[model samples]
Target: MANGRAGELVLRERRSLGGADWLYARLRQLFKNSIVILALAAVWEVAPRTGLVNVTFFPPLSEVAAAWWQLLLSGDLGDHAAASLSRSLGGFLLAIAVSIPLGLAIGWWKPVSEYLNPFLELMRNTAALAILPIFILLLGLGETSKVAIVFYACSFPLLLNTISGVKNVDPLLIKSARSMGLSSVGLFRKVILPASIPTIFVGIRQAGASSILVLVAAEMVGATSGLGYLIQYSQFSFLITEMYAGILTISVIGLIVNYVLVTLEQRLTAWKPSARE
Candidate 1:
């Protein structure tokens, strides 16, 4: 009788756990993640209609939505968005390709670090936008100039973060590895590189934002076919709704890019304990 009762209790406990798991899965599947976004959209939709702001300058959300749909349907938005994406990605990738290796070398070698530090500080201090005329003069009012602007804007963040991350790797960890007779290459590969991954990702995120910002400004100056150009043209033509739609598209693109980078970071760092826990 005792054994039979024990078996019955175990079965009941298992059933309870299974039910809880099922309920959690259902909740996750049914979650409405856009509630807050929808609420903000509602406010935007209502504000101009209520005369809280001038609809001419600050068009209502409904008009913006209509414009967005129209642009999407007409396919003009896609072409401009694609052009902007190409420039942004081209410059950003070039920065990453150059910055990471250079950063690693600087962080690892005292001579390189000392040699580059002053020049880096000087370059980083200068405003990237301030160099627009120089770039246009050198590279012409072409894709090269715009892309170079993005590269200049994005490189500093990643390069600085990489140096910081590598240099900040715990000294004790290096000592430990040295005591174990690890080679210089082995120490860097096994210890310093792993420790710096998170910080490097942080730099990547910052660079992505910078790339978009600089690209937009560069487009505003000379481009005839990017989202920035679209926004500028719409504003000049007094098509406030289209301008707002372009602005909204930029915001969404930024959010999506950041979201992707964040997701990638989370996956790569899953072994680390999250603050939420």
Candidate 2:
């Protein structure tokens, strides 16, 4: 009887576990992994307070927070944040506009793909910063130039991802849809677009990141009113605390952008399963 009861309990537990969906599973997985970050923060806070490490380069958490508070109250932080966001989003939006239709055409049409893919591969491989001088010469050291640099940096990933996503769309699915009276337009709209979304999103996420990186570099090179500028200014003045605060701002913005993109991807691609889940 004891052995039979144990088997019954195991079966019940498996069934219960199987009932949870991907969201619940992922939350559980992350819960198990977050201990390390909490421990690191503990160390950061503890070491400076205890004088185990020099506080000059690594300002105490309290000092950093104080600097951040002062910046926030003065509205300077908000202004810098807005400037960076404008540059990144403006460029990112332009990339999406240019890359999506071009990607579709290149992916679906063999002649176009063969003719254009080689050049695209070269551009994608080239470093964005390497051509900064050319951009500055063509557009000057103005907002237009900064935005253009970001667009150049971000467009490659979006184009490549769009092409891959469209090409890898299942022919069998398209055939079945056609058999069921889906016209070329209908089939593409319903099946192709939905099917390619997961892969296409990967490119979009990368493009978003590239936008941030390129914008920071642009600001570092010339701009005087962004988070990157704040860091540079603080460094020149030897205001180490303010410099660290600017760095923390950059980190926070990157984290927020990544989280938003991840959330959007999850919401849009409900049919897929994540590895973590």
* Candidate 1 backbone clash number: 0
Give residue 242's error in model 2 in angstroms: 1.1
Best by TM-score: 1
Off by over 4 Å in 1: 1-36
Q: What does candidate 2 score on TM? A: 0.85
Which regions in candidate 2 have their CA more than 4 angstroms from the true location? 1-33, 273-277
TM-score against truth, every candidate: 0.88, 0.85
Candidates' RMSD to native: 7.3, 7.3
Model 1 alpha-carbon miss at residue 114, Å: 0.6
